[model samples]
Target: MLGMSTTTGHGHGHTHDGINWAERLGHLQAIDALDRDTHADVAQRLAAGLPEGATVVDIGSGAGGMSSAFGRALAAAGGGTVVLVDAVPALLDAATAHVRAEAPAVEVVSVLADAADPALPELVPAGDLVWASGVVHHLPDQQRGVNTLARMVRPGGRLALREGGLATQCLPWDVGIGTPGLQGRLLAARESWFERMRADMPDVVRLPGGWGRALAAAGLGDVTSLGFLVDHPAPASAPARESVVNWLTFMADMAGEWLSEEDRATVARLIDPHDSAFVGNSDDVFVLSASTVHHGTRPVPPA
Candidate 1:
């Protein structure tokens, strides 16, 4: 699941268009751990057929999990550079260290700059592959951000944007403790909350025609959209269980107000580790999430 920026009274903390790294480091780290394998798979597919020393850029790289995954893939492709860009300095530092430690064979660079910055291309060099996962939605002007990223892809190189897909579904539809359709209600509330969050963003601009058209409008060719699934069946791993707990806690905190009192109480009990009905402790608890990546290539000039 992607990190979202919103103002909330939730103790977890928040930042404008980014996670509050100092306060929510544990939450971010847990998510990275849960998504590590899926991220590596995406990296492998994206890194295929690249030249020996390809340059890959990861925009809005958080905790460097995806960036490091890209680094490892690049290393396997011979050798290359993985540039990590983010607005948060701490995240940038963490990602830099993580990439270096995880993919020592590949060169790593970090740039602390907002994705919406018009001058971003001046700071980061063109990339063989530009990757931005769960990032464009944070910008006030999404298409402008996509255009900026497109500018960073060298001719013939690709730009991949990981955006919409089905939200994670961990608890069963009938989780005995809550109402029969607690998960459905929660998803509804989350959607409403998300709409409000986007509207509240400063200078927010509506993105018409979705990401695929956005990529095409950016002057990229051969646009493609693909989805990657992260599925952990019943008896989920410790990290997956923990990630589910964290996610529920976040939703309960951030969207609790929109939920009915009964639903809110149910969520509270579900996330409480000590509760006998805690969802994470259930043998039936599972994890399922799908992330869609939109790809476009900067067309090579005709001979």
Candidate 2:
């Protein structure tokens, strides 16, 4: 969710061409490092109970980070293969390299398919474990997307997703320092865009049980939710600082549409390369956030 502003800026159909996603990806790479241990633990829990040669698929596997986590866990669970699926060709290419580097013993398959497409189930083979993170919100029809993906889960297999609204998946109003409310304004702009997207896609907001309900709607059972917190403290590392700067800069560029005149001025000052309020050189800059994952299993059909 780190580079979300670029794709859904202001949600009013305005695009920020100046946002450098490559740079955002780089920052995300660093931020993800902070959550490595948490992901590994989650992978282990998900890989448990599966036999040797289990098949795992990570839908919308950006940069192959989750793919690498699951690959390593499955490899340790007596070896298995991980298929990394995404709609972007370049992301798949990068994911291939990342998975190969992080999980050399595990086999990797890269597939390009949109998560929202109905044909998504046909393009990929059935698997023992299917995981989708930070992608469901982009789908036009959340229920159809969930059911379509669930169909690819072999009977008795499990389906897991990391899903949440934009407001719950953002940096705090005060990220320890910098312009006191700069991050808040940026998040407001992002939320405005997300609200618009949600309005267009009613299915997203209509999920009564959130991810768990989506799982049940897909005919899955034993659904459960797991929570994880990402807290990056002050005196942030070099990479963290770089990530924070890149994210704020990009958000500031696209905030004009949703942010008020005063808020826009705040964003401009905070993002100005030479200004004292600039986030890049601010000593108090940091990030603290959290997210949740919903896990469910597909019950074996009656004989």
Candidate 3:
């Protein structure tokens, strides 16, 4: 269910793909809004080792934007095949349209495959590259996701992913370096958002055994991250700063029920509509283990 709606995604139209494409896409789009430069950064990781004419499968290829980028890349090296899979009909349709519109000769195929189904390999045509972003976290069962991803890759193929880790476990939303009296509110906000998320889309946000542990257990190779920033500094990068600001805004929303109108206003000031609070503001990294790219070969029966 890469794009299906769940409490985790605040009711976006997520599909029933084994991975939630909608939720993942929603998040990627959010990141895209600010972290635009990292587009190439991620593509390079996911596309590593892609050879001439290598077939590629994009599991949660929402709106088909990211997968399309890869598909075009494959075509550049050689006429490789691109298969876009998602349980969401809308996403599939859009992906198909994107392929036809952008890179028709690359052999783009769209399928309604759910990652959880053990039969997905049979359902999907084979490929040399397997890629997904922000996918594992949204799966109802992380272990299943690990298994499904492992199963999809052909021998010598790569399965790469970037998932949001529990970077920060409920901290003060506004306790910045210069902000005073933020510690009390930050602590309270952390408690409030945790309760709200648990009450809502607990399935999507809840991590089992942590992302790294789970990915390692899934037997993924080359797993690593940006080391999960506890709190971050506002980089000169606009997108990174925007990401931090948006996070603060979300934290405030999560704590809305527990805060007074005046306190909420303060929270908004820290992360809303404009860029005042962000000038040299110290950002809190969620300890997210950001920028994780994992690849491993799945064993196939000796033919």
Candidate 4:
């Protein structure tokens, strides 16, 4: 998905909203540091009972980390084809490289297309397993996107989409002793930015029921929703720490126009590299309060 700035009319004139490549890499690295085990476990569980040589599609495969994990799991089942789909070309490039590095045994295909585009299925083949991680919400019509994604899956195949509410997506401010509501304020800032996006982009659809209901509405059966919690108490990995630092700093930058002096001070301290209370410092532990996985299967006819 495009960064918040680009998605909300900030335009592609600037890559990553002025955030450097290191910070962007930090975000992807954070995925490995924080959710590597949880993502692998969930992918293995959901990908069970799959036939060898089956195909897998990863929608919005940012930096290809999750796609790489799925590719590795699918490779264990005698290898298969993995497709990485994303609107951004650079991301697809990174994803391709990452997937190849992680699972050389699997065939990897990269497709450049918007998740909300109706013609997506035409460009990509139907897959035995279709995975969309936080892709639907970025579309203009979430239900339409879900329906389109459902159609991309062959009968008897499974669909898994990763999404979560604010509570699950953001770390709480109370995790460290520095600022009591730093994280909470940052989340509020994110919501404020989202509101601005909604106002600016009226065509973009916002789903009320989120992923579970979207899958169900697409005629998927055996629908299930589960959540994984990543609670790193302290001494977080370098990548995870950097990711949080970048995130809080970005929020502060985005919300700078509206943030109160007190809130700004809190954000400054939270992102301060040398400050003991800084999120990315050795003393701070990065925590993903929760991460949710919603899945369902497309029904097949009886033999």
**TM-score against truth, every candidate:** 0.91, 0.82, 0.62, 0.84
Looking at candidate 3, the ten consecutive residues that score lowest on lDDT are: 2-11
Which lDDT value does model 4 have at 93?
72
Q: What digit string (tens of lDDT, one per residue) describes model 2 on residues 188-285?
A: 78777766766765444344557788899899999998877665566666655666766666666655678777766765666677977666666665
- Cα lDDT of model 4 by residue, 137-242, tens digit: 6566778888999999999998888877435334554755545765666667777776675556547666786677889999999999877776655556676677
Better-scoring candidate (lDDT), 1 or 4: 1
**Residue 235 lDDT, candidate 2, scale 0-100:** 64
lDDT string for model 1 (32-112, tens) is: 888888889999998897877999999888888899899889878788888888776667767788888888888777777
Q: List model 3 lDDT by residue over 48-126, tens digit each.
A: 6776777778776667766767766765666677778776666666666766565655777777766555677777766
Which residue ranges in model 1 land beyond 4 Å of their true spot? 1-22
In model 2, which regions exceed 4 Å deviation? Answer: 1-24, 165-180, 200-209, 253-255
Name the candidate that leads on lDDT: 1
Q: Which of the numbered candidates is closest to the native, going by highest TM-score?
A: 1
Q: How accurate is candidate 4 locally (lDDT)?
A: 0.72
Error of 4 at 152 (Å): 0.3
Candidate 4 structure, TM-score to reference: 0.84
